[model samples]
Each structure stands twice: as structure tokens, then as C-alpha cells.
Target: MKTTTYNIDRINHLIQQYQLGKEEFLTLLSEGLKHPLTWEAVFKEEIQINHLKRIDKIFKKGLSYYLDPTAPVTSKESSIFFRKEKFGTNLNLASKKIVSQFEDLKISLSGLAKLSDINLERKLPVFHSHDNPVSVANTVRELLMPRFKKDPKKFLNALIDTFAEYNILVFEYVEHPSLKEKTNIDGFFLQPNVIVLRRNQDYFKREIFTLAHELGHYLLNQEEIESMDYDQMAFGKISKVEAWCNHFAFAFLAGNELLNLDKLPNLTARNDYNFNEIKTISDHTHLSFSAILTYLVKKDKVSGAIYAKMRRNQEEEIQNRKEEEKKKRELEKEMGKASTASLAKPIQSPLFVSTIQSAFFDGVINEFELCKTLNLKPNQLEKYLR
Candidate 1:
């Protein structure tokens, strides 16, 4: 039966309350209606197609940074590495490790906190007092500036990547959240040190900026922030703390200098194509493909309508490709692990969420660090809780 308008609005209201993003909002919307999208759906849903593609591109670029910590920054395209999916552990199985580590981490933290008076100087900062992206960028740069003597670029990158190392450690490939989300986020600060992606998947350039933006929040020890839904933000009445986090994220990622529109005209003249000029400029600036495109439109390098059309077209194409692949993989079922493998019988796997939960319940781990390690929101993992 089709849902009534009232039900649909109710559903939307729930999503808004939970802070879901457009991608996540659409996903939850479909799932809540009892029509979970499949690969076929991707082809049908142009927006999702574009989103997944953008995410995959960022994953690839981010992977490059992971593969060679010391590799030259320009080696982004070349230095990236990947294992054949055929050889990688199924994601369902991989998630168990996070559960296990959560317990291990809890114990470590508890030991330190009880034995010593460890005072956390938890003060979060944003651009001194402005909304400039560059201001926040400079703030983060300044925060990490003292560490410049220690591999400057990597530290700069780390300012944006909170959990890059954890991602490298727990899973061989990027992890799609093991659990379903009821909300959208600007992005989730999944692991304490890592920000699971939110946007910047398509143009391939905005990946760094978005990641850096999320890093701004995590750097200051925030848990969850609203997504790019400005409508909600306008009437939503977020706390001052949340606003500060947003300011930090914007500033840290795009840098005030990069976002200044006045300077963009000059930039366009300097290069045959300015911010919107694809190909070399994105790579040269270490910006994502989308960031440059959007900036171009903002600078009047492209019309808003044209930009919107391009975005839609790009999103549609990517969704189509993903849907096609999803179909191929579904057909390859016998040769591949089933998505249901995530619910693999408790005794079947080598990894153990059982052990992790037990340890936490037994007081072997501290709550904060345990939750951090599990990549879980405080009370989200029902099975892992006592």
C-alpha cells in the first residue's frame, strides 16, 4: 500500500530530527517505505548514482594518501593502491573487529583515568569570530602549525583526517557503516579520529575539503553535527557549540583565501579556466572535482542552472553505472558473499563481537574509548551492550 501524505511528512520529520543528509535522507526515505533500493534503484535514482560515484572517487584518492604516507602530494593519481575485492574480507565480517577493539580501548582508557588525574583540556576553536572558510582553514593550519617540523603536509592532511590510521588498521577497504542510519549528517565522525564521508564524491575534488571539514569537528571532540540541510539549520535552533563546530569545519577545510569570490575573477584570467576549469586545476589545487565546479558557478564562471544540470546529469550517470555494477554483483552471488553475511550466525566467524561486549560489561574497558573504538554511537549497538 502506498503511504499517505501525512505518513510521508511524518517520516521526513523523523529524518530531519535525526540530522540526515540528502543522500542519507533519500536512502532512509526509501528504506522506511519498505522499498529498499537495490542496484536497479540506483539506475532509477539519479541522485544516489552521482553520490556513490563521488564517494568512491574520494575513497580512491583518500586511499592514495593511506597507501603511501610519505609519497609526494602530487602522486595522488599514481600512488594509490587497492586490493582486489575478491581478496578483501567481506564488510560484515570486517565490522566485528571494530567491536572487538572497542572493548580493548575501553580497558586502556579506564586504567589511565582511574589511576591518574587525566584532565582533558577540551576547548574547541573555530575561525577567530567569522564565517570565512579560509579563516577556519588558517585556524586549523595554526593549530597544527607547531607540528610543521614533523612532516608538515601529513600533519596538514591529518588535520582533516581524524581516523585515517584507524581505517587502515581495522579494515582493508573503506567501511560502509555496518548498521543502518536513521539520520543524515554533514558527515559522521565515525571513529573518534576519523570522519566517515558525507559529500564530494562526484567532482572528485571536493573530497579533501569535505573530509577536512568533518575533521574540524572531530579535532575538537564533537560527536555528531547536522548535515548540509540549511533549511533545518535556519529554524532548527542548534546550540552555540554546534555553530562553533560548523564554523570550524568550513574554515579548516576550504580556507578563507580559497573561498573569497573577489579573487576568483583574477584566478580565471591567470589560467585559461579558473576554478571551474576541470582537468589539471583540481589536481593542482588538491581540491575535489565538485568543489572547483561549484566555486566556478559561484564566481559566475558557469550559470547556476547550467551547474545544476551538470550536477544532475553527473549524478544520474554515476547512479546508472553503480546500479549496473550492483546487478552484476548480485548475479555473481554464488561467487560472492551475500549481503546477509553481515548477519552471519554468531559462531561462524573468527571475529567476535561477543568478546568485545563481554569485556566492556566486565569492566575491562572504559565507556568512552570503547564507544570510540566500536565506531558506535553511545547506545547504538544493542547486541554489544549489557
Candidate 2:
């Protein structure tokens, strides 16, 4: 078999463009390829690709995580990400919306930042495509590199623990339980206070990023606006306040240090976002296979034309896999039992704290899972537990 080598400079450029690291870039690249797999796959048992494809529905109605405490005077525009996507009443309506909710964060970013003990020292690689939504979201992943632990569970536990500390409710995940839509994502919040998660979403790497993005909205007080979202089309057109919230998510997860665009060399064009490389990085960062590939295309590390083709390929693969699953489900359905799964750990009661020692002493699990399973993972669990 021929080996696919990556172009370091090109990979670096894409990493820089999307403020990604070698691991994050490779994970997404691999996911969208002929046989996408993240670096995490090496340690993880090979998982069948789950094709829970569906649009991300963000609600745009709740009012949380949007207040800027430090600012003495309230300002109307507390953000930098926006383009007038339409004219006429669209502009007027959007302007009115932005004006009304600029400095009204019910939640606090700095407070959450201070509360987070998950480690926030990763250097974010700079990406040139600051204007792109995908680029920005991927950049947020950079902020999380500093806390990278080989064990996926630990990373998630830390995130969830922090969310719980913040009074977020953790939800029991059931796959596609919602009649509204389906998703590959592990966790999502419904509105002012409803979080839906697929506890079955076991990919550690991508799950971390998803947790961060969704929580970012809460911390930045964009939860209400996101709740109002009726369609995915609201992504770029969301209020400036919402844009800032997303930027904060990207910045917090990816971090400013790692994302300096100056480091991106033209050579990153050769990162080769192939199946093997993706596996390498995903293994390192523990990101999800699907997210790893999505980030690569968004970063422009992979060609647009090629990315489109890969999307089609992924769809076909999903179709084939779904057919196989249908057969499995048909067979399994006869048993008339539900999937057997449990929380990583027994959730702490409404009481604010649980000892790390208690988890290990209980003999419920080993040392590693105990340390992380304090209920943290970032996205749905993060918000739910918060």
C-alpha cells in the first residue's frame, strides 16, 4: 500500500488559517476523506461512522451569557462578526435586534473563564479566514489544546465538571430522541434551559469542541438568541452580540497564543488531509472523526472542490452504513430491549462538590475515568450540568 505524506507548510497554513493544530486539522481532514479517521482512532476501537446527519438548530430566544460585566457603560454593539446578508427590512430588523441585545449578557464570560480549571494555556495558531463562521468555530478548538490529556474521558469530565460548577444541568443522552432532527453531535441546548444530548456520542475529540462551542454561547449570553434560531441560515446573520459569543467560543477553546496566522506557511497545502493523517492527529488530540474532517474543509486546508466531492462521498458512505444498520436494528429490535449504557460516573447531587477520591474509592471505575467523569464534556453536558 502507498503511504500518503503531508506537506508540513500547507498543513501549517491551514492550521493557521483556521487557528488549528496538527491534531485538530488532521482529524477533520480524515473524517471527510475516502476513509476518514482521526488520530484518536489508533487508540480507540475502530468505530463505524454514525451518519446522524442533520442541520444544527440554534434557538435565538433565550437571554443568557451575554452580559459584559467589566464595561461600565452599556454599548449596543458588543461584537465584531457581522455582514449585512440582506437589505431592506432585513437590515432594519437585524439592526433593531442587535441594538436591543448588545450588552445584555445574563451570564459572564470572564466569570466562566475564571471558573474553568480545565487549563487554558494552549497557543492558538492564527488563521487568515477570520470572517468565516467555520473558520472561527475551528479556531475555538485551539484554546482547548493546553488541556489535552491522552484519555478522552478526562478531558470531557473536566469540561462537564466546570459546567456543573456553574449550575448547568446535565442531561441523559438518547440518540435522535428528539422528533425535530438528527445529528452527529453529542450535546445541544434547546433554549433558555433545555439541553438535548446523545450520551451515546462517544467520540472524545470532536465532542470536546462541540461542548465548548455550545457552552461558549451560554457563557457569552447568546443562549437566548440561539434559542430563537428557526433555521441554520441564521448563522452569519445572527446579531453582533451572537457573533461575539461565537468568537469568544473559538477564542476560548483555541486560545490566542496558538492561533497566530504568521505561522502559516504556504507549505501547509500539503497536509494531505488523507485518512491516515487524520487518524494520527485525532489520536493525539482525541477529537471526533467527523469533526476533524469538517474543520479541515472549513479551514481551506482542503480544496473547496475536493471538499464538496468528499461530502458526497461521505453521504454515500453514510447511506451504505445506514443500510447495514437497518439490518442490525431489525435483528436487534426483535430482542425488544434498549441500548445498555450508563453515565461515566454517578452524577453528584444538587450539592456543589464531589471529591475526586470518592469516585476512585467507590470501585465503580478505574482512576482515569473517575478523574474526568465528574460530569464534564463541554457541549450538551456542559450546558445541561451548568
Total colliding residue pairs, candidate 2: 83
RMSD for all candidates, in order, please.
18.1, 21.4
In order, how many clashes per candidate?
32, 83
Summarize candidate 2's per-residue lDDT along 121-193 as a digit string, tens digits.
2123323323454455554444323465677767666656555544453343333344344432334442232
- Least well predicted 10-residue stretch by lDDT in candidate 2: 51-60
- Write candidate 1's Cα lDDT for 1-386 as tens digits: 11111122322332332334557645533543455554344433123434343332322223222223242322211111111112111222223233223333433543444444332222444223335544555755654422221332343344333332222111111334464422233343333332344333232233344455455555545444234433232234555545555445444444434545335553333464343545344434454445555545534565555555655766787899979977877887967766543421111111123334445666766777556555568667664674
Q: Counting only residues 3 or more apart in sequence or on different chains, how many pairs clash (N, Cα, C under 3 Å) in candidate 1?
A: 32
Model 2 superposed RMSD (Cα) = 21.4
